[model samples]
Target: MADPDGNVARAVKLETATISDALDRLGIVGQCYGIKGRDPDFRMAGRAFTMRCGPNSTPPGTVGDYIDDVPEGAVVVIDNHGRTDATIWGDILTEIAHRRRLAGTVIDGVSRDVHLCRTLGYPIFSLDHWMRTGKDRVQVEEMNCVVAIGGARVGPGDILVGDPDGVIVIPHEHEEAVLAAAEEIEAAEDSIRAAVRGGMRLDEARRQFKYHSLQTRKDAE
Candidate 1:
């Protein structure tokens, strides 16, 4: 679980299989805050490579520099302090990220290049979209630092799960435990679903499985 690379690969695989399931299992809460006209169905699953920026940071060597340094298959998470004046991601950055095989990006700011991202099918979750660059509004203060995305605290190596629904962060320290809990949750849900199909009442299914108590006791046994 401490191995960032392995955790990312596993997260990606799980995401590819079950985006909604993962979100349900992780108990994520955030709407899909993305620019219109882009890939609205964008979903990304990978380890987070966080960036925290403040006003007055330089360009071409600030956030972009750290972006270039992020390993392949990462999910770049940018916390621009909720700045909306300039765009943090754009067409060219999307291209580079795709080339690097990065999973996607989550920005607490604006992004650009809607058409290109749509065509490329790259996932980018952000506050807004714009044509202006983040030249004067933002600068990368730290790379791989803890940042907030949609009010969720995320750190480097944490699992980032994004989809049409929203984005969720699973802290690195709880990766394995969360995954295991998710699997158990899924299994119990499956049984409940089956019972429903077999003419069991919804409340009956919940009562039998003790669904409300499932998560609380997941780590106990």
Candidate 2:
């Protein structure tokens, strides 16, 4: 999450777990399930550039050609209905995205050329990987549109935070409040850790921080 400015900001430190907790506090369902980072240490934060994929309408419908249109710092989120038999991503796309310095790509389908992604340090979160190409098996139905990732709807410009734990999509309209909630959750967890380090029992530290309420809904509170 480290921005180039070295601001030591929460954006550079919030984990998916904390963000997920924040979403819970807000009664939002956004955690993308089954998508895993290619590199466990990889982390990314950026606005989503969403696209939808569907079975080839024609026998040989071509795969998407929208990668060149993606802006820098935007994450590519594609919905392929969690299909692992066909891949919507490959080494060429990985190389190009790395060169463009895009945040990352999240796929509801598998990807090919996983080794290239790892070697290039290009971050990708996906259901799995395989050698099958998606060129004719699937095609982009639309771009900058609503898409699903692990059953979670994602739209263009939505904030995407991903890490080893997984990816979470924050609705654009709720970004501010979600960030605030996440920061608060992170701080409370830090306090609990600090107290534990100072010889307080784990239970005592959690109790002091009201840890159990960290993800409690605001309405319930």
Candidate 3:
């Protein structure tokens, strides 16, 4: 495992493997939803620096300007407040983001440049896809501020893990503890899996290892 500060510095270096391992161990949901009907396809790990914007606040120049400040490999998480009139991300910005080595982006509203983003192999999770530009409708209000996604409060420096499972925000203060707990959970699960493969019943393996008792042990420790 990487040091906390190192993990923080190389925020995008953490992989879906580590995150999924953590999620399995922790038994928590990580993905957020804004799109209706279908779940978004995203598979990148990131550290968030959230953004809040409203209609008429996110002009092209402003969006470009804000993205320039993001560190390399960081994921830019945005809360557009469900605005569907104007798109928050598009081709030009996506190109810039890729150049900056960003892991990906997640928006609580709509976005444009889907084909470009897809071609670039950059994952983008958004409310919807559109062709209308974010011209006079959106504006950037704040960066590195707390924003709500799928009812969860996300703050700057939070570990943003996304995969087919969706996105989950690991609080900055809880990162180390959560990662450690997740690791332990993965080890136990591996043992359980091996037992099941060797003919032990699933329930028997779980009971033998006290898998369900993890929370109590975690809390006590």
- Candidate 3 residue lDDT tens string, 72-160: 76888888887777788888888998888887888887788788877777888776788887766677878889997765668877787
Error of 2 at 153 (Å): 1.3
Say which candidate scores most in lDDT: 2
For model 1, residues 129-215, the per-residue Cα lDDT tens digits are: 888987666677888788888677788887887765566677777777666666666678789999999999999999998777664
Task: Please rank every candidate by TM-score, starting with the best.
Answer: 2, 1, 3
**Candidate that beats the other on lDDT, 1 or 2, i.e. the better one:** 2
Best-to-worst lDDT order: 2, 1, 3
* lDDT at residue 200 of model 1 (Cα atoms): 100
Per-model C-alpha RMSD: 4.3, 2.7, 4.4
Candidate 2 per-residue lDDT over residues 1-221, each given as its tens digit = 22343222345478889989999999998999999998897788787889888888755665657888888888999999888888999999999999988989999989999899899888899998899888878988888899989978898888888899999888877877888999999999999999899899999999989999999999999
| Prediction 2 TM-score vs. true | 0.93
lDDT of every predicted structure (CA atoms): 0.71, 0.86, 0.70
Q: Which pairs clash in model 2?
A: 1-12
Model 2 residue 82 CA deviation in Å: 1.2
